[model samples]
Target: MIVDRQGRRFRNLRISLTSACNYACTYCVPDGKRLVAAQDELSADAMIQAVAYLIEAAGIERLRITGGEPLVSPKLEALLRGVSQLGLDDISLTSNGQLLTRKLPLLLETGIRRLNISLDTLDPEAFRRIARGGDLFSVLEGLDQARAAGLKIKLNMVPLRGQNLDQVLPLLDYCLERGFELRFIELMRMGHLARAGQNFQQQFVGLPELLALIGERYEYAQADAPVDATALRYKIAGRGYFGVIANESVPFCRSCSRLRLSSTGWLHGCLSSSNRHYVGDLLDKPRHQALPALQGLLVKALGDKQELAFAGGTTIMKIIGG
Candidate 1:
């Protein structure tokens, strides 16, 4: 029942299954150290309990399972196995596709019909240079396998100047041809990028420039999106849809209804804020005892949401999930 001053409430929850990532993408990890799972990550059962508790506590209607790379998390299948029966409106996953092919059967059996995969470029060298890890061939093959498996896939690409900005159009063509939605996420001033100063500004790309690049080959118009949807959606005439998560040019903080829970059990209300509420212990407590405390904490979490623009934060996106 708690809503922010801007009328935003927790309708969507993104839970990070693990903090450990297989890839050290340049944008995500400026220092090039791969993230590792926290020593105290919650067990699969406890996380499932939290999801159920939150359903009643905050009226969460959607769930996105994320990770340092969720496929790398050993608890993924078990977690999904338990979460699938909860009857949430939808359950999706976000991954780097490094292990999607291996996990496709688990995803299908668990009824995960849609997912978001991060793929910035199709070039092998660029993939290595940017992701800093993983085989692009494996990822590409995984994508094909998932597509053939009848999964509704969406591709996420962060457009950065001097990095893979040139790949935007080709990547879009790749998505459009395959019936996958391509989402161009504008680079944010987050993590080390927050302190990157001129370098951050230099490499950062915005919506106008992204549209201009895509406009060179195709025409598109603004399309409808959920009120709390982060990405601004668009649809082309003959091609499939594309979206722009223009955090810089068109901040959607006012309508942001996402609540992030790290694998080790911390509720992050806003990505741009450092504040986090610890609800791990509550997950093990009785409902009567946990519900009251968790609801109180949910209010604090909701209050932590940004009022307008995303000012950015020092916390790495992997720590809390993307």
Candidate 2:
């Protein structure tokens, strides 16, 4: 296993297919501030080869395909097909659900059985405002299609203080009725949101308050997640499972088993920093030579993995492929 110096084995690999996106979420890639890679992104074959080497060398079994929005990448389907053929234990995708309705069949055909959709609020106006001109109806249609496709669905919600907090209980009800897992991520002060003028303090909400509110209404118990998983999961009795990814309020750095690969093939050990090592160069080497070289860099990087600092970063969430 790819155990870091701290003894955290890295088993999950998150790869970004593209830095392009459709929705302009306020907390993520805000309006007029999208950052696409200047360097050409690795092609489907190259991505597969790189990931295959990592899977073998690092013993990474679980793979997650992310992006500014993964569906935007034309090479996504091919990439997924190639990686799935490697016999990886799990393969999942994280998307905004904008174009997912039409691509559901292709996604499943390409071997992605699990999906995480970014759906912050159930309200249409709130969605548009928060997502900066996103269509809530289209996302709903995508969700319907995903459920019909028999995919394990998880809704990733970032609860802003005054924005989606009102819809919290309603969102829970919706997820429970549909048997979908709900993950509430605390509003992180990173990238554009870290600006002094962004008023990030006003938008922040702690996980404790959310848990207390949910506990008051539902009979929920802490559910066991994988040792390396970041989210603290809970199963609300007779309803469905929910998770609180309190990265800031209750940091899960000690158990983080993820290493993110950007669209341009940059490797990031931490989510809060823009300092990424260029792993793409190793892809140019022959398979036999690349494996050992890539493994060495990964081991050195993991050895230097440090706890995250959530303030003052220019790299947007899309570029990091979170």
Q: Which candidate is the best by lDDT?
A: 1
What are the lDDT scores of the predictions, listed in order? 0.93, 0.82
Model 1, 1-322: lDDT tens per residue? Answer: 9877678899999999999999999998888889998999999999999999999999999999998999999999899999999989999999999998899999999999998999999989889999999999999899999999999999999987898988998899999999999999999888989889899999999998988888888988989998888999999988789999999999999999999999999999999999999999998789999999999999999988888899989999999999
Put down candidate 2 lDDT per residue, 140-239, tens digits, no spaces. 9999988988999999999898888988888999999998999999887667786735478788878888998787789888999977677889997777
Candidate 1 TM-score, C-alpha based: 0.99
CA shift at 183, candidate 2, in angstroms?
0.2
The regions of model 1 sitting more than 4 angstroms off are: none
TM-score per model over all chains: 0.99, 0.93
How far out, in Å, is residue 221 in model 1?
A: 1.2
Q: What lDDT would candidate 2 get against the real structure? A: 0.82
Q: What is the lDDT of residue 4 in candidate 2?
A: 59
**Model 2 misplaced stretches (Cα beyond 4 Å):** 32-39, 195-198, 307-313
For model 2 the TM-score comes to: 0.93
